[model samples]
Target: MKNYLNSTMIKITLMIVLCMSAFAFNDSKVSAKDEAIDLRAKAAILIDADSGKILYEKNANKAYGIASMSKMMTEYILLDKIKAGEISWDDQYNVSKYAYKISHDTELSNVALREDGVYSVKELYEAMAIYSANAATIALTEVMAGSEKNFLPLMNKKAEELGLKNYTFYNATGLNNKQLKGMQPKGTPEDGENEMPAKYVAKLAYQLVKEHPDMLETASINKKAFAKGTDDEIMMTNWNYMVKGGIYEYKGVDGLKTGSTDFAGQCVTITAKQGDLRVIAVVMDAKEENGDSTYKARFDAAKTLLDYGFNNFKMQEVMPAGYTFKNNKTIAVKDGQKKEVAIEASKAISFIANKNTTYKPKLVLDKKEITAPVKKGTVVGHVEIQGDGYGYIMPVKDQATVVTTDDVQSKGWFVKALGGIGDFFANVGHSIF
Candidate 1:
């Protein structure tokens, strides 16, 4: 880990590191750029989780009804509260009439919350994440903020904090008023429906996992029983087909959520890991084929995007050991045993890059020279990997440890101070010349 740049500068730098290749996955054949996959999604995005690099996107910034995919934020807020010690996983809450109605409604998915049944925070969260239990989410919201109405403000505040310009949370469960059968509070913004751009959702998912990685502990659960040891106990299975043993389960798919609705159609946000690389892929508003709108389109689209990434991209060290940046040069080191210390990369750098393109990175130093007493492992410069189609600019810091010159015995304090003053100006001159 290294201090690379300010947040804004890193974003700007990442935005510029791109190469657009004309290729899209269709069946087993890689088609021409113009023949991009007909994902039939309103919006989508595939990105590198570590580098924030966009691999592919279609209408990624356009807002659309997000359906249950909005629950990721809910999960984020819940974990945040729990982690903050405001709540505990063992704390119990009784199911409300509202929660019971949604659970037994049969029209929506649920883990069958009974108004009389008491459940722990952990149980409800599991139902929501793995089973997309609408009632469980509403119930948890009730416990968290005393009621769904109060919880709405917290969700909106979080969205703003996250800088989600294209997202709006209207309900804890991602349902619109119509889906709620008029149960939604009237005249309140939270009573409406939720909407967000596909890319922002991806960013949200990435940020959620990055910060609260332990959320995956429950999100990855593929199957479990609700109300265990009680007569009301019911089995819950993950809706995300990308998970293991799912109908369309792909390799490496782990914790994630899926969503579907009349307006939102079908959607999924997925995260997967392969060795050093982790990626997030989002598919939203997937169209139903031949009026048979099943979840297959969303699954297939997500798979296609992920397949495009794992097959075509490889994570490479931006400036690995035993390699030198093109612009790196030896600089004079005052009071050192050696007259000069060779400038070298200080830290490790790696990024997901296109397998098809060759990388030729350039090195940029913050300063061309340094004074003696420079400690080992000091950061003096960074390596900027040139972008290509799918190229991402990652600044690998130049570490002081990599600089090979040694320090010599100093004369007396006065002598060393005098030598430093003269060499400081000299090094500055050399830097300019």
Candidate 2:
């Protein structure tokens, strides 16, 4: 029985070792090189989500009217509500007279709610997020909480929480509204271009990608239709044709929202990823003069941003201190209780380059020694990394898992008795979170 049990344990341990080894090997192979692409937009941005780096920009700081992009913010605020337990996916609601009226008043995109039966929040969220159904969005606002009047406050408050400095929410559907009499020009220049809320809308959409990327599965979907069930019935199609059928090559091309109004022209917040890198592309009110299709300009600018990010960036592994990129020495342990522990990184490491620079990275670990009851992945010291344009550090950790130590290499007399106090507090933060 002892021999059988010993063989089983060794097999299980080796399997775990192999799995971890695969993940570690994969981490070291990240590499990329940027290739030029075309863009056509008056004001656009391709932003790197991890480092907040701007990969490409055309009047990126300039703000203009964004049509349906506003829906992204509205969807974000709604998702926030869902996450915070303020609402549930299956929550039911009725479209009030006012909401129904607003939805039907003009040619704005709508899901066309009827008074027959209650509709679940899930159905409505799909209409707005996947289909950009404006009417459905208004109906949700009206039925879910009370009124768009009440919901707009919630939207503003969320904007503040996301640290959006220049965004604002006007309505659930984001149709350009003439400010009710007394409101100032929102500091937007009175260009008579019906100053659309582009920046605020893009920021809200950015929050969606930044805070909850899982929604992309739903957002990136192209089109779907509904059959008449007892509760509700509606048909919808994705307005962003590029997403449904066009050739966008970026990997993990998830979702966002798209918008267009004759006045608003073309606008979108597009999300895509390559490796660990994810990006958000935003464009508002393009002139459309550069191409026959306004969407061509937006997609072009979006492709420009995506290509710059994927082709130009790479991820590197900065080995822990007292360890090597290849492997670390069998570290000492306490009380003969030697077990394997991986070293910890001092910080999340990254480097960025653009058309102007080429770079190389070097690793620097702080200490060459370690002490234990060194739990696997316990930080003992640090290592630094320097690149052509930046520098980073890798922290050392307890390698060989440790236990109550009598072995002096694992923990010397002084360390066993006194040194673990700081570690206790650090461990508290890690364990609690």
Most accurate candidate by TM-score: 1
Q: What is the C-alpha lDDT of each candidate?
A: 0.76, 0.57
Score candidate 1 by lDDT. 0.76
Give the C-alpha lDDT of model 2.
0.57
Worst 10 residues of 1 by lDDT: 391-400
lDDT of 2 by residue, 1-433 (tens): 9999999999999999999999997754332223344555656666555555445555544456666676766777777788899889988877666555544544667666675546788888888887777667776776545766676777667767766654445665656554222221244322322233333444555557777877877776766664356344555666655464445434656777777766666777777776777766776655455454466666666666666667765553333223333454334344323443444344444344443443332333344545454544454443444222311111122122212212332545665556477778889999999
* Model 2: worst 10 consecutive residues (lDDT sum): 390-399
Model 2 CA deviation exceeding 4 Å by range:
1-37, 178-203, 227-234, 244-251, 287-293, 316-348, 352-356, 359-433
Q: Which candidate is the best by lDDT?
A: 1
**Per-residue lDDT for 307 in model 2?**
68
Alpha carbon deviation, residue 90, candidate 2 (Å): 1.5
Clashing residue pairs in candidate 1, if any? Answer: 19-388, 19-389, 22-33, 337-408, 345-399, 346-398, 346-399, 377-401
What is residue 20's positional error in candidate 2, in angstroms? 51
